[model samples]
Target: PYHSVAACAGLLRAGGFTELADGAQWKLARGGKYFVSKGGSEIMAFIVGGRFCQPGVESGLSIVGAHTDSPCLRLRPNSKVSGAGMLQVGIQTYGGGLWHTWFDRPLGLAGKVVVREAAPGRPDETRLAEKLVRITDPLMILPNLAIHLQSAEERKAFAVNPETHLQPVLCSKMFDDEAGKEASRPEDAGDARHHAALLEVVAKRLGCAPGDIMDADLCLMDSMPACLAGLYEEFISSPRIDNLLSTWAAVQGLCDFAASSAVADCQDVCIAVSFDHEECGSQSTCGADSNSMSVWLESLLGALEVPPLARPLVYAKSFLLSADCAHGVHPNYAAKHQSEHRPDFHKGIVIKTNANQRYATTALTSALFREVCKKADVPVQDFVVRNDSPCGTTIGPIVSSKLGIRTIDIGAPQWAMHSCRETCASSDARHLRALCGAFFESFRNIDTAAAKM
Candidate 1:
């Protein structure tokens, strides 16, 4: 997660956005237009006018919302703990996760930091925004209880509880034994004391003052890198592919669109945003539910100052593609997915459907996506949550309500979405990129009556 955010920030810098005071946060504007992407691959784009050219012309804000954060366990501040002569670091699951899959994997930590300097009452502040600090030396480990200690029923039914079992080993603390035995040192056993000690440890690692440490949001991720796996190398096994694949594809697509003139009259501003905290509900400043995108879009519109009628025209004409990830049916658990609705890897973009509208993809938007895919010569697939099951969500509906723009929820299908390592097809990345590019270039005046019909 930390590396992905840094990479995204670098991409945004390459596109010319000034980094905001808040470490990884950044913004860029051109004329009356704006484009923003957080940590870099997650993007949200905006435009001011073109309203007069189309009906219901209110605004021309075309949003493509994708999340930068994925499911993973975050190390707690006082994560270090010792048990029965063993040392471990406490971990809390950041989002809904596939808990059992996390056991026994090599893990690393990464996140942004606010460093403080020596000063009584007022510490000097320095933020290491996108700097990912990884402590890979057995920083944590969760050991499973032995089967011999449990009843047959207990052994047969295993459950993972984040408050306990997910903690990782941080190594021995025996070096402190002699110092503690030596004297005037008081016995330390409070959360605050532990937090202070950990903060000091972090400060020492960064060469900053212990007082300089402020607030931080960090997570422990699998030390494993994304790799091509399976027989014949047919799949990609990596951490956070649930949406990173879409984030990468969208960034690649936007870059491609910006460099091409093949699709003309294409002055609709381009944007790519990857907001933070999407794994949980998106209610933060950097989330879809917040004012970040809203404020940014309004500022871009004010800068553009399109003709009054053009605002409405832009809305009537504009579109949004909520690029998220979809679930590929597990062959072993095939009954959990609709047979006809299963999407194959490397095939193309997958149009997701949840009758409850858990997904923002509508009939009209899906058709539009299909048209774009057809025009781009990209193969496409469809996904529907099985009747007996409830599906997870994405950034689609949140952005739709926040911006009030037409949107189609789409993604590349993959397996084990919230696991420590997820899998997907290799070819879908390129195919999705092309489809997104085509959609961006082809967005213009659309027949609403025909669309509605």
Candidate 2:
């Protein structure tokens, strides 16, 4: 999930959006397409509309927001664990994941790895570099205990203790057999902290000596690629679909808007934000809870030379669609859903609401979004947690409170949400993109239509 920045940044750059460094001064202009990244995981892209900079222009940003991270198992520091001739990797569960789904599944390794650089530089000092590594091959597996091995109570509950049952087997532990296969030199010796077999696999992927891998931040993932499923291929069976679907859809909409002629006459800034750390909490520099967007906005406003007084108006006028995917009503456990507010697959966008402020949606925002969807001819639905159930949250409330941006929580329904593998209606992603793109293209006009209200 942390790999999202590279994919999104590449997409933006390919779409003619210039990348801006956070540390550098920004000189934004009307009708410009640009993006900025922070903490290597969070990204924001924008198309500064032609209508920007007019002294009294009422239009503001049409923004879509989603998160990049999801629930998964992360490799702990010093992850090596061996018993009974098998080497296993110690794992730490991240977020509230369905740990049971992870058992007996093929797992791949991915994330940032720190490697050594040229021994001598500037001051002839040894340097290091971080590289993203993803080994697509099925490198590990957490096999479940067989039915015969389980106690009667365990068989019924199938309760998984993450600490006890989550360790994934990497390979056979033939410690003596590896002695001669490993590099012996001080510089050539790989990170002893990790199992030798694991180091060898990663080093092989990087085409470097195992010892070159100094440190790493890796997680286990389903090695299977996402694919179309169902009799008519109407379902998207995949991993990380919960938020990645929203993240991808938002960026695609932004890029489509940037490419279209609408930007030439558009009256508002069009921005797509994919923040990190939402699954856990958005408190990081890259998270929506922080000043990432504010900092970027301040820089842009300063560069565009908007009047100090009008800056507030521009912010006040902005509307943000918080687009984290919602849960679809389960077929087998349909009773668990709110009877009056069940969201079905492929039923279009779900406008999630909560009385306790779990979501940031308000009556006015919901009305505005509904109007936009209606004009665009897109279907819409609503969802609310059962009174007896606790409502889940998204980046909506955080961004709304922090930036004072008008926000509404929205998502396309999906099933098996935090599982190692998940499912979503294939067409729902298309609808989501269409709705977001329509919102970007039509927000200014919609605002005009509702001016009297």
Candidate 3:
């Protein structure tokens, strides 16, 4: 679990969504609002439609899928690496991050630590507890090498080697005595692999003894707050803007729709799922590649007592809007984008297409989403990769393939993806939210019309 996972939980609870346990028997009610996930990093919320719950009536799902992960440096076990009286923590690049951008920046460590509790009768058996930890006050830094030390080629474009250059400095050896005394540790052999100062900070944050923390899934986070930039604050300068913005848009869209009068007329189940591990291959248990969606959907319909034979019909009627982020044409690197299909910021949501099936978008899905945007009065854009460039993929293809749902890939336009920081138009987020809301409210009716043709 990370900071965003906790905040997401709070937001869903505040939005009047009840949580369901993934392993327990579901007792869902008609027009009920619910969320379910097995881990902290994953969340899926849904509102059952009253109209669809009627006996013998067919309905489907309108899902908006986004990812909760971003590229960053994750701490490794036995991270303690020290030399010349200065301590540094070893880190492995978690995803395809711009290695150079992380240099010389203030960094915070935040993630879940598995705390161990002694079992009374068994020394080898311990109960594990997870505590979310954050050392957010710039306690670490990955300073860049001085420019004078760079080669001519490096000076022109900074390049970084992840193994040697990315480990962040934590503290000096001077704190070894003082912080170590305060953070009492076990005499276990593996305990020496962690820096005392690092453990001290995590211990203080969680108000637990340092020795209790057996293992951690810590990562380096940029210690910068997202802010408005550009003339009149037209742009949002932030970290994790690529997918976080889309996650927010999906949740906000659902909340806004649930509060509006149109919700009562919605005939399909509306859902928003923010999955983890998308930055990687999304193969984890909570990832979109997993059977999480299919399992939960089947369970929900089973709980609703939908006939086994009619379950396939519900899947056919479902649709998914795979919301990620679109690469806006960068002013300095405009040639990298397809000339006629480059998306711009604040213009609206971008419909992404790839001939190689990198995206799940089809003519049918695009037409439906376009009408949704039109009904919402939100502008829309399109994105296509250049013929010579390789296209990035999203959860759309995987989920659409698994569930056979009519799916389209879409996003808010952004710049500098996979960097320490990124930028995007402020209005694009609002447009995305509006489009999502309209899609949830109108997708069923629109799909019905499309089917008639």
TM-scores of the candidates are 0.83, 0.95, 0.94
- Per-residue alpha-carbon lDDT of model 2 for 170-274, expressed as tens digits? 877575247543334344344777777688889888878787888988989999899999999999999999899998988998888888888888888898999
Which residue window of length 10 is worst by lDDT in model 2? 180-189
> On a 0 to 100 scale, what is the lDDT of residue 64 in model 1?
58
lDDT of 3 at 185: 51
Best by TM-score: 2
List, residue by residue over 1-453, the lDDT tens digit for candidate 3: 356667766788898989899877899877778888767788888888878746655589999999988999998888989766778898989879997898888998889888877677889888988778877688889888888998999988776789988888888777765656424655554556787678868988988777777898888888877899997999999988978898888888888777877766667889998889998999999899999888998888889898899878888889999999999999899999999988988788899999899999999889999988888899989999999988999999999999999999999999999999999998998898888888888888777877644
Instruction: TM-score winner between 1 and 2, please give it.
Output: 2
Candidate order by lDDT, decreasing, is: 2, 3, 1
Q: Rate residue 121 of model 2 by lDDT.
A: 42
lDDT of 2 at 251: 91
Native-to-model Cα distance after best TM-score fit, residue 266 in candidate 1, in Å: 0.5
The better candidate by TM-score, 2 or 3, is 2
Query: Which regions of candidate 1 deviate over 4 angstroms?
Result: 1-3, 15-34, 37-59, 118-132, 136-138, 175-201, 209-211, 262-264, 307-310, 445-453
